[model samples]
Target chain A: MISLKLDKKLDSSEGEFLLSIDIEIPKYSFTILCGDSGAGKTSILRMLSGLMTPDTGRITYDDTVWYDSRQKINLSPKDRGLGFVFQEQALFPNMTVRQNLAYALAKGQHSKEIDLLITEFQLDGLQDRKPATLSGGQKQKVSLARSIINRPKLLLLDEPLSALDQKRRMRLQDFILKAHRDYDLTTIMVSHDAAEINKMAQAVLSLENGKVSRITRPGEMKKVSEMTSGTITKIDESAEELILKISLKKKSGNAFQEEYATGEMIWVSKKM
Target chain B: MDWQPIILTFRLALVTTIILFFVSLPLAYWLAFTRSKTKPILEALITMPLVLPPTVIGFYLLVAFSPAYQFGGWLESIGLRFAFTFPGLVVASIIYSLPFMVQPIQSGLSNLPPSLREASYILGKTKISTLTHVLLPNIKPSLLTGIVLAFAHTIGEFGVVLMIGGNIPGKTKVASIAIYDEVESMNYAMANNYSLVLFSVTFVILILVYLANGGYFNQISK
Candidate 1:
């Protein structure tokens, strides 16, 4: 388990606020920090990765103390033994994809791992190309692959897929999941997409104004399945198909989907 | 035309530029990333050469290298005399061109996104490796600018060399100083030859830097 009691004063778009938290992250679990913009989500990940220091705190992984303000004990990021993927792709622009991965190799570590990563990410043909020549999704994939070249026990991602399109976003999510399971990593990611949280995270820490407002399991999927109904506003007579506008109740927060309806007279529920 | 002065001038510039490249790398890295309270003071001292007259620095070098002073006396005790010598010209040129070498590299380092450094650190690379492999590679244009500026600045310097190195045909008489001596003796042809050579060479060097940095040579990148 990684336990931390952190305190930091930060300035955001809305002004300054104190980000205080006391939380213990379960080992080998996928955790998500969900919040609006400027809610200290990314800052928390940075603090955990040793990229940003807390004003006062004790961060411990098992028995090793990562940081303690009073003891003056702080580990450098290199010693923290983790991987970080920034919001934007942070691949070395001057290096080819293979070279970037090779550069991340530790001493005495073999190049076979680099070859495997390139194949795993489906970047085989693009391995000899620089980052500037790739698309946004391709670049982020390379960034992810490079970060985990050493197979770290921990992974930190800050909105790594926010810039990608829907198709590419889903594609990268699968890659993140595979890496998470392949290494059994203790993953901490900051994201605002609830569906993605539901698909990837085991637990979610919803943040508001630099504070954890709630710990919610992302089971919005179950709720949506239970109460989904939409008025059949239009019917296509040519194909003998009914068009269903599946908007649930106003209280369900606007769950909507369109589907090709059958001609059966199915009873619509009052709650839906 | 005697080529000794021109050769000596290039030798001094080359040596000074080479030394400054190594020295400025560490200095620029610190200035770009440090939170030290004394940064402003140190920065001002390094940049003094840019605004102050070269003769002001030249005057101080003369005082420090003279055998009458304590420093000069100690230097002489070691059987080393920098005053009016080739080594003296190299040292003075380095000081007079310090800012030219440091500023561009510093700005290049600062302009890079912070995530590049943080990403390298999180990947389990040390500070030195991160600098050499990641930070420095991304600032190629800045490094070129610094080298070109320092080399050209040292090549054109006259006041500092005149004060500290004086005039010696094979020892301290660089092209700029030679031009001055030639013009003083009404040797306009010799002065013009030296002047045109210096001008054409520096201009060509600056043009190459501009073209390379502007992506004119970037055909293969895309």
Candidate 2:
């Protein structure tokens, strides 16, 4: 299990925002940080990947302390054995595809793995081509292949498929899913797309206003749907009171309505 | 035709270009990446030699490196001499042609995306390795341009080499200095021969540069 307890204040020249998040991710599960832009979703991943230092935090993977402010210990991204795939694809334009993959493989740790990755990612014929010559989808695939060539313990993807078209996005998503299954990686993906979140995330963690407001399990949606259906919710403007006539069927359904006060904006949807 | 000066000029240019390649790489790297408060000051310093008259730089070098100066005295104590020597001429040429070496490299490094460096860092490569294996290879064309420009510029340098090296034949005399000497000594025929050779050499270099830069010469010729 990887436990991350981050209570940090992020203040650039822009302004100060507090990020307090406490979450435990079971090993080998696909976790999604689902939020809108500017919600500090990428910031969290940056912290986890050791790209950004938090003001205060303790992040531990199993028994290893990846970061601990009290102890003044922080591992670098390379030492942490984490792979990151940036949204920009970040391929080295000078290197050929084979050289790029070989760069990630440990020194003297060569095998048939590179050829396998090239073939697996459908980059067989494009090994000699530079990143500038490759298409957007091809570049992203190369980036993915390069990141996973080392078999990192964790994979941090920041909007990996967001740059592609819809068809390419779906194709890359399927590739990611297959890679995740094959490696059983502890994966953390950041995405604003709700459909992507639904398809890939075993647990959805929503970040709002620089804080993780919700960490819901997969089955919570069924219960939320069941509860929302049975409540007769009314807002009384004179007293500013919310009245919920909760019957048995209404009790299981419209639970979010019960939890939220009347006149407070909430998204109501039927069970999908 | 006496080929000694021609050989001497090529040697000087080749040495100057090689030395400038090493010197300019770090300068270009810092100019491209650093956001320090001193960056603009350093950049101005590097470009100052380009704007100033070569005679001015040569005058300063002659004074600072003369046998009477403290630095020159110290260099003499270490069994080294600077003024009126081939090495002195090289030093003067390098200073004279620094901008030609640095500007192209600086532009190339600046135009490169920073994401490439960040990606190398993320892949666990150290800064030195990233520079050697990643950044340098990507900027190969710029390095080539810098070398060609510096070499050609150094080959044509006259004022600085004249002031510091004093046109000693077969010792400190390069083609440009020799050409001046020939014209001064009423050897117009030899001067013209030297001029033709120098012109052809320079023309070929310019042609290569234009062709490498993707047919700019063809468009201009048209």
Maximum-lDDT candidate: 1
Per-residue lDDT for B16-41 in model 2, tens only?
A: 99998898889888888887999988
Model 1 / residue B166 / CA error / Å? 0.2
Clashing residue pairs, backbone N/CA/C < 3 A, model 1: none
Candidate 1 wrongly placed segments (more than 4 Å): A218-272, B220-222
Q: Write the per-residue lDDT of candidate 2 for residues A1-272, one digit (tens) a residue.
A: 99888876776455787888888889999998987677788788888878788888799999999999999999877678878888898888878999999887866667688998987787989999988899889898999998888888888898998877755676687778878888879899988765567557888899987778888777764544443333444433333223333322334243333342111212222244
- Quantify all predictions' global Cα lDDT against the true fold: 0.87, 0.81
lDDT string for model 1 (A1-272, tens) is 99989999999877899999999998998999988888889889888889899999999998999999999999989999999999987899989999999998877899999988887788999999999999999999999998888988789999999998765776688789888988889999888874477668888898887789988665644553344444554443333223332223323455534442222222212232
> Would you estimate the TM-scores of all the predictions?
0.90, 0.82
Lowest lDDT 10-mer window, candidate 1 chain A? Answer: A261-270
Each candidate's B-chain TM-score, in sequence, is: 0.97, 0.94
